[model samples]
Target: MTEIIDGNAVASQIRDDLTAAIETLADAGARPGLATVLMGDDPASQTYVNMKQRDCEEVGIESHHVDVDGDASPAELYDAIADLNEDPDVHGYIVQAPVPDHVDYREVIRRVDPIKDVDGFHPENVGRLVAGDARFRPCTPHGIQKLLETAGVEPEGKDVTIVGRSDIVGKPLANLLIQKAEDGNATVTVCHSRTDDLGAKTRSADIVVAAVGVPELIDGSMIGEGAVVIDVGVNRVDVSERRSEDSQTASDQSDTEKGYELVGDVEFESAKEKASAITPVPGGVGPMTRAMLLYNTVKAASLQEDVAVDLP
Candidate 1:
């Protein structure tokens, strides 16, 4: 039987540890605060921001929600970031991504102060990551690293194949795994849309990371026996029954209302049987992402408080 990599369980463990750490900070007159800049009414972005706020409350971290309109101008967005940058009380903050088409993401990301950049999206933070300096590691990649560590699946001296070459997950993650650190040092291979013979590379890997953003892109046939598969894609698919359900709704004008459901790049059911271990879609990487945000906030506070922390 294949072992399920329980991301929720692992994330809970990290949250618990961070909660205790927060309590310790509170005793010393230090309280960590996370400010989230949410622009637009993107339902998914709102849900993600809400989850981050809820997680902050659970860990005794203060959260401030800065709501802005989707139609807000680039200058307006930059003004908000500038305000947060000057706020000494705010330890860390993240500007929810996919800002309205009008707002430039690159410019907004550049405006955030590197120290308060919990998302690690700023160029300074990215540079620090590449330089092996511990400022703030990108949350998603850090979470993935934790998943591997908590599962006791060391990457060292192993063939680690990662699909997708995005800065957020693939590239930064590869940098971390291939670093000369204890948790990393793996032989890394990155594949993207341009890559040929994808399965040939995946089937030879001891561990496979799927982040191609397409559902069921990888099946059992593409994986090596006993390989560890980490599914990072969150694609929505509409099934027959779901389509029927959407037809009953009053505002269901779209062609497919009831059809979509979150699925990973890998075919979970079939891939599970072939792989030694696998992470499930809904419960995997998602929780870990939020947990790592809290970890980053705590670290940000520690740095501000002049307290040293050992981070991987």
Candidate 2:
């Protein structure tokens, strides 16, 4: 029987484990706090920030938000980041992605204090990660590692084929996986759109991670039997034309809010058949990102406030 990796269940257990550390921080009079800075009104960005705030509330982390106009000057945004760095109340913070086109996003990352860069995008934190002495791992890649651990699928000595080269997910994950550490020691191959014969690489891998933004890119034939599959893409695909006449007899298709539905880079219907374990799109990697953010905030508080708390 194929096992479905349940990220929601795994994330819930992590939250439970974190509650004890949170209590410890509270006892020391140092409740962890996380802040997010937004520069635009992108719907997706707004939704993401709102979810983070909600997660912070549930996890006992004080949440703060700063909204900058989409047209704001780069200096204005830079000042906000600097203020967060000096604020005693905020242990960590993230500047939401897709800042104004005029702003140098990379510069924004460089300006953030490495110690408070909970997102781990700053060059200093990224450098530490590459050196195998990371102060803070980026949340998505870090969350993916935790998910693999929870599923009893260690990367040590395994062949991992990651299908993306973006700095956020692909590059960092590849670096971490190839390191000589607990979640490390894996042989990793990073592939991008330019990579030729992608299937040949995936078929040889013990684990396949699909992170490219394309929807339903990898199918069962590309995956070797008994391999673990992790889908990290979240794309909304238009399924209106594909709807079958018999799909939903009771519901009116016209009444649907949108014509699109969520999908991942891997074709789940086909990949699950040959995989030993796999994660679903909406409930899989999505929850782990938020969970790790909370985890990082707590850890940051422990280090900055000199509060001793046992973290898992």
Candidate 3:
């Protein structure tokens, strides 16, 4: 059996470091604050934003939550973000994802000031990321980097196959991997839905990143021997009757009643048997995502100082 890379333990270590850093900032009379604008009642988004708020408390940072209804007009949403952008107390802010269908989500991203865009959705930050400037990295991909570092699977000179091309993960990670740094300098191949014979590319990788949302997309056969697999997908799927019955803890039983549970793109049990290392879904990249979010928040706050961008 391959080693399980425990992201929760790693994220906890990061949070401890962040707590001390925030104390120093507080001593300097700069209280770092994060403002989150969440439109709609997306259960997953709400949970994610709430966890971020909880993390803020852990690190002695203040978080403001602005909840809007699903039908909130784009103008109303933009106005709220504008207000948060101007707030001196708010060092960074993120407008939660999957805004209502009628709202132009990209416009909302465009409206956020780059300096205050902790999520790195603004084009300015995105451009900076692509230019290899030390700026905010999208949280999830940054979390994956941390995982790889903590696991000692440095990407340098390795063949990394990224199985998605979204601006958030695949595209940015591709740039990050090839950057001239210790954790980077990997020869990266990005595969997507349009890529032919996907397994052929994946089976050759020293590192495999499964960010495509399809469940069990990368089986044991697709993973190269001794490869490090990062499963970034969080897909909700209907559970089997036997599996649900076996998941008998009160909380899990309740979850089964709710219709579906979370599963990653790589099937955990099978992938664990094949890869040299792998990240499990719920406990893996999820917590690290929030840790990297806090990291970005601090970086945004520090931008007011003369510290150089220390991007990896």
In the range 1-312, model 2's lDDT, one tens digit per residue, is 888888898888888889899889988899899999999899999999999999888878899999999998998999899899999999999999988789999999999988888988999999999999888888889889998998899999999999999989999999999998988899999999999999999999999999999999999999999999999999987666557657844443652456667889999989999999999988999899889888889989999999888877
lDDT of 2 at 305: 93
Q: 103-217 in candidate 1: lDDT tens per residue? A: 8899899999999999998999998888888588888888888888878899999999999999889999999999999878899999999999999999999999998798889
TM-scores of the models, in the order given: 0.93, 0.96, 0.93
Return the TM-score for candidate 1, rounded to 2 decimals.
Answer: 0.93
Q: Which candidate would rank higher by lDDT, 1 or 2?
A: 2
Clash totals in order: 3, 0, 0
Q: Any idea what lDDT model 3 has?
A: 0.86
Off by over 4 Å in 2: 248-255
Please report, as a residue range, the 10-residue window in candidate 2 with the lowest summed lDDT: 248-257
Leading candidate by TM-score: 2
> Which residue window of length 10 is worst by lDDT in model 3?
303-312
Q: Which has the better lDDT: candidate 2, or candidate 3? A: 2
lDDT, candidate 3, residue 163? Answer: 99
Question: What C-alpha lDDT values do all the predictions have?
Answer: 0.87, 0.91, 0.86
Candidate 1: give the clashing pairs.
Answer: 238-259, 238-260, 242-258
Query: In terms of TM-score, how similar is model 3 to the real structure?
Result: 0.93
| Model 2 C-alpha RMSD to native | 1.6
Clash total of candidate 2: 0
